[model samples]
Target: MRVTTFAAFRHRNYRLFFVGQLISMMGTWMQQTAIGWLIYQLTGSKLLLGTVQAIGGLPTFFLSTVGGAVADRFPKRAVLVLTQSVMMLAAFALGVLVSTGQIRVWQVAALTAMRGAVMAFDMPVRQAFVVDMVGRDDLMDAVGLNSSLVSGARIVGPAVAGLVMGRFGTAPCFYANAASFLAVIGGLVAMRLTPSPRMVSPESVLRHAVGGFVEVRRNPRVLGLMAILLTVGIFGWSYSVLLPVFARDVLGIAEQRYGLLLAANGVGALLGSLVIASLGDYPHWERLVTGGVFLFGVCLVLFSWTTRFHLALLFLALAGLGMISFHSTANTVIQTSVPDAVRGRVMGVWAMVFVGTHPLGSLLAGILAEHFGASLTVSMSASICVLVAVGVSLARKKGNGALRPNVTGSAGTAGQES
Candidate 1:
């Protein structure tokens, strides 16, 4: 797109942060690709694959709100640095266990859950930290570019991990992921930014955290978006856990080809993110988010019915486009609309809605896949997403209204503090 499409890169701190995050996210995706294959390869159980994913989501469900409160109470940079370091250690541990031939299904599950716990804290802080770096004006661009970076990583990580795991095995993927954290650590260290002014509350921690809940409840737009997000997270995202099954059992593709399937999805997501970036702080974010959800459901349904590998890849790519469009828009809208006072805690609830429900979906998907077959399970999930989108549309017609009319104009130039 235009150079203006990447205006967020004009800010030095955001540029540095973006580069570091890109590297780290690539590693994270590689680890995810390898882990899914490893779990399935070891257990040969679709249920267990879903179970591992469920385990990963469980901590986020339980602790993400508290994690958001922690983000508000503490320095986000310090929190992120600490969390990133712990995640690095966890990755190394997984590598060691896998490389030693000592890795078991249970160990993988436990480690996945542990990383999820760290992410419960890390996701909100990291997301909230974006505004601190770019401020309000470039917030939309920053969000879009960040998502593009993630989608870019998704492309590189899975394709490379597929080859890497196929050749050197899964351990190297974990080790590589562990080493990649250094980039993020370095970025955080190098950045120069003043601390953000918190809407510091006089209330107790519990009361302060609870106040975030109240803030969201008072905003109909945020409340409705959160409801839609929860539904999407629960039904729309669990296709990830089923990919290995889809590749092996449904499409009859080899393990090496699995990465290609995942990469195809990434390519679509990258395209969608770039389009969002090009839009550059557009006012009609609700349209983008809702439309994306509708397209995602349609693509997923198409993907479910496809037995041909090439066709499946095309459908998966379309689904990825829709998925990222919905997600990035929702993220930018909430971040820009909320007051900085409770941003962290509010984002914590956002994290809970966006990710917390995945555990439930993963568990349900697993059970459904075991009995109903992968194609039908995925098709059913896709149907739910379509229904959710339609439901949202109807609800909006009944006067739920747009997200924060005040946020409708161009972003203010004042950069948010650290």
Candidate 2:
């Protein structure tokens, strides 16, 4: 059977969720671009930029485990509603502060931290909820499409934010982001989902959290994937913290051109996501995951050294493509390998390593950039990622089978209703 990229769209709930998320995420990207630009404008300090990002991510690092447990114990949709509502309020508050010209660096940090805390609960639950919407059969397609949605927004949001900020300022971006939440909330309200059985453990939330860690430890495949994700998350993804620096200092570009650079990256990511979606039931996930990481690392290293605007954009686009390819495949592999009962908890652990470590990466990048300059710091970080990818590939060659896909055995049951 031919695999269609839109296979997941057959499910109504998934369609609603997808449409809502695409719209909302565009606003999210806008806000994210604005925040980074605003901070860079306000402080002009690389260290402060990284510091603020670190503060924002710290809450997810600490609390995502408990958030995962909450997801397993409650209805995922309801949890998302609450979390989304809080996030909307926080965005609006930031917009108000910015519009009134009373926005300080501390205020930005505080609001960012608030949103991060909400996302600790939001992200894992939202990830696990994909199965609830479309079940397991089209999970990979759904995952790929969802990634494309994010990347698609990434493409448009930064470009539009640049125009908006250049004309009206950053406040409008925040306000726009706050308003975007309504689409998602409405979609959640409109969905008619059959609630799956909850894994309501009699144990404490801490115990449930511990069980998640135990699950990762017991599954060597998951453990290996998590290790790679951690390495990439820390060194590879954190390079984004330096983009504003690269744009202003190295590329000598204004906001409009900077936005184009971001959009270039997004376009690459979107193409990568489409490739994944079109693969249907292809089984060579290990190849995609490892190759994608290697490509991303190489492109990032090249991008870090390039001062020419066009060359930098080309490298960043390739890096973005590699990034989403690895991310989407890894997520599919992990989700399929785990049981539904513990999916949320496992994803929570995933969030802890993947999202949580971002703060450390950002902070480290900032400190390094402040002393060594952004170009050298980014190159050094990307080089680490390259080394790690090569190591993983060599290890896989040794027939350890840790990174290989095992989708047909017990794992195949992951998509079935609980």
- TM agreement with the true structure for every prediction: 0.95, 0.96
- Candidate 2 lDDT over 41-63, as tens digits, reads 99999999999999999999998
Question: Using TM-score as the measure, which candidate wins?
Answer: 2
> Candidate 1, 186: how far from true, in Å?
0.3
Expressed as tens digits, the lDDT of each residue in 373-397 for candidate 1 is 8889989898899988887777666
Name the regions of candidate 1 deviating beyond 4 angstroms: 1-4, 196-202, 397-401, 404-417
lDDT of 1 at 408: 42
lDDT of each: 0.85, 0.88
Question: What lDDT score is found at residue 366 in candidate 1?
Answer: 92
lDDT, model 2: 0.88
